[model samples]
Target chain A: MKKTINIPLGSQHISLLEPVRFKFECENEKIISVDSDVGFVHRGIERACTTKFKFDAIGYVVARVCGLCAITHSLSYTAAVEKLLGGEITKKAKYLRILLLELDRIHSHMLCLSHTCENAGFEAMFMRIMGDRELVMEIQELLTGNRVQFDYINIGGVNRDINSEVAKKIIENLYEVKQRVLGYMDEFTNNWSLSLKFKGIGALSLDDAYMFNAIGPLARASGLNIDVRNEIDYLPFNEVGFAMQTQSEGDINARNIVRLHEILNSILMCENVLSGLPEGAIFTKLKGKPNGEAIVRFEAPRGELMYYVKGNGSAMLERVRIKTPTFASIPVFSHIFVGENYADAPAILASFDPCLSCTAK
Target chain B: MFDLKKYRKKSPWILHYNAGSCNGCDIEILASLSPKYDLERFGVINTGNPKQSDIFLVTGPVTYRSRERLIELYTQMPEPKVVVAVGSCTCTGGVFRDMYNVEDGIDRYIPVDVYIAGCAVSPELIIDGVVKALDILEKKSKEMEKPLKLFKEAISENGVVNRRNVALKVGEVHEEN
Candidate 1:
């Protein structure tokens, strides 16, 4: 007899924020094998993009794919459309785009950090971080008018421009958030449950990370220095103070530290964008429908988010394919669950920050 | 004796199920429970178990595969419970109305008492929606007690009135007499 009992984790579980199911074959407390289903949140957005909506409107449609990384979805689609149409947006628009993108990343990472703490059974830390995350949400709402689904990026350029008062407010909030993140850095490094308990659990070796083709913080945590922000020159991430944060442990602790450091780096990038914003018109009014195929990659809060858009010079696009980071990370998630205690499953899953909505969409 | 009504109003545990909406509404729900919004001040806790929960806070337009689990959780919830549909997609399928894999809205599967509509419902709106759910929950509890009250009335009338009088009132008993 195998002497293994199967435990299903989700589809409607409290530990999960989205609908993802994980079936773990456990022998006593140790998990022997893991099976996961990631399609519960699929709403057929990709097919709708090609058949129902036009190329111009797909930017807004794709933003609904996942509210956490809405800005990245719209940005990648807009960039691909711009590529297909062969148009150049003004530098000011690009700066505004980066500002919003970085703001989105800061909040998403904070949410993930809070969730990890919650799974660790540190309820107070979860509450404290969640309360502090409101600072980033405030600035995001101040800049884009909406907290979650920004829908700020469009094909030609960004829809809104930043004024001095708004910039001052954003800068103030970012400064406050930076201070709070520093405090969290101390807590994450020194705390027993968050730091020590997470050190060696659910670890992925560097060789396994490479073999699994891990992206985003998951790969970066395992000493793989691959970041979409560093690879793509379309957006001026290098001009800003964007640095790749990496760690060697590749466990829950390293992932948390990488995310915290990334939050700090993202805040610096937002400040740089505000200070060095170029003077130009925000929108260029690119004319004509997209007639070519284009692929654009962006660094979402989770990892690399790529969009494939094909247009036939008609009102509707022929195809709108999305490659979400969470969808790509399912392999790494399944691989990491084996040989770990079943009790640590939720905390480890939270550390990966699997965005199921993005994966299914 | 345990007063289910009084305690149900004071502390209504929430069971959140993501039927398949984007994660915007789900995070807002969490934020509302956190310190700033402080929905927990009203004694609402998000629990994983369905049996102990009073409010079913469901987000998302029903996806193809998730509809079964959505109903399973709904049926597992005890009687006199309230269902709050958060986000526009969960209410009327919002942007994903005509999507192939989705079944439009959650109302097609589960009965919704409160519908909070926003692409991504804000924390303030989520708080408002939950407050409204508390009222509906209280009302449903009252209704659940109605049948017992009627049955008690019939037994009491059997002693107070004659057989003929009780028989005459039998027709009226079917009504809310």
Candidate 2:
């Protein structure tokens, strides 16, 4: 006869950055079932977007959805509004937008990687990655005024422009970040203890990935070819050398490798955007209230982010719906936890890099 | 024997909880603990268990669903604790003020000793707030260590001995004033 035991993680755990609760049913050491509560951080942001903030200000408001993916949120909302208003932004602004978007991806992915290391009990690795992450953060601060919530993208285009001095600094920083990432890649692939914790743990197969409709690194690690960056033409991702990174193992290590490779790819794209930036104005003025409905999709650091905006010829929006990546990946997250050991639960959860704020919002 | 109070003052473990706001403040807090900010230099460690933590660092505006957990964590923490609210939203419900699901701020559920103000408070500000919290924690610890005294004359007309009414009378030896 077998007896089942239940263990609860989070709502507030050392491993989790946000409020998310997971109830795991274990038979001995193997998890039999997983139940997750992701609504703890929900502050009714969707309702507030329509009711509290106006169409012009909603861009910045939506940035509050998730700080790690603030640029993607604001970018998607602005793109939707621009679609409704029928505005064409400048090419330079487009390049700058891509620059910030990729920069955001690099830092966000670094944070996730460091967090995974910490969860796997590699504290030194966590500190190293986090310390190096400040290089990207410094470049972001130089580009935009603030560090985390840049509020860089506005209605028609971008809020800030990059000069030669900032451009040089960005390139230098990217070089340092690239070298650091290569070192991390070596450690992740060859380190025995890290492999013991990460290798073959929390594996999500390609079939299950597709069946659960996984997106971003979670899906790509499982060998599924789905990325909003490749699918969407709103940004010149292909022009700036955006390449999809994937891994076949689909375990914690595969996810880390995918993130590391994506960080490299994002750095290359940022370098490309900075080097061959088009000569034009960063911001353009659009002349009227947005009318009608528009849907926009962009790839955030974690996964795909979608924004649906419905507006009338008034100050207020009729409706605004935000579909965040982690929100969609929760089902898959639950599914992956089924067969994993109870001790590996935190590492597995960190590997997914679930953003509860985005989910609850 | 090592003095636990002195050790606690030197190294105060922290318990971080996200009540409801965007993850901006939470990430900033995490960044501060990392090497760049090096919050650990001040002997600060982020602990998961509430009972072992000395300083409670809370982010985000308290939401309806999280209010109970927020209070639960606060209650589980041992006495002589300090609660630091990190972020504009957590300080006073900055942007999420009038939202239906939000409870304005964490202070609605528990007392906030230090308030760091910013849409997303930077790591520098977080370090400063924690430093200030250490002082407050030390003071609270000292206050908790003081013994209470009973005074019969401090009883009110309702036959209840009010501590606030007695106030300095118990803690102090009065000369004939």
Candidate 2's residue-wise lDDT over A156-182, tens digit each?
898877889999999999999999999
lDDT value, residue A322 of candidate 1: 97
Q: Please give the range of 10 consecutive residues that has the lowest summed lDDT in model 1 chain A.
A: A190-199
DockQ (CA atoms), all models = 0.84, 0.71
The DockQ assigned to candidate 1 is 0.84
Query: lDDT by residue for model 1 over A1-361, one digit each (tens)?
Result: 7698999998778899988889999999999999888888888899999889888888899999888989999999999999988999999999999999898899999999999999988999999999999998998888888989888988889888888999999999999999999999999898876765688999999999999999999999999999999989889999988898999999999999999999999999999999999998999999899998999999998899998988999999988899999889999999999999999999999999999989888
Instruction: Return the interface RMSD of the candidates, in order shown, one decimal each.
Output: 0.7, 0.8
Error of 1 at B36 (Å): 0.6
Question: Would you give the TM-score of chain B in model 1?
Answer: 0.87
Clashing pairs in 1: B21-B60
Stretches of candidate 1 exceeding 4 Å from the true structure: B147-161, B168-172
Model 2 clashing residue pairs (backbone): none
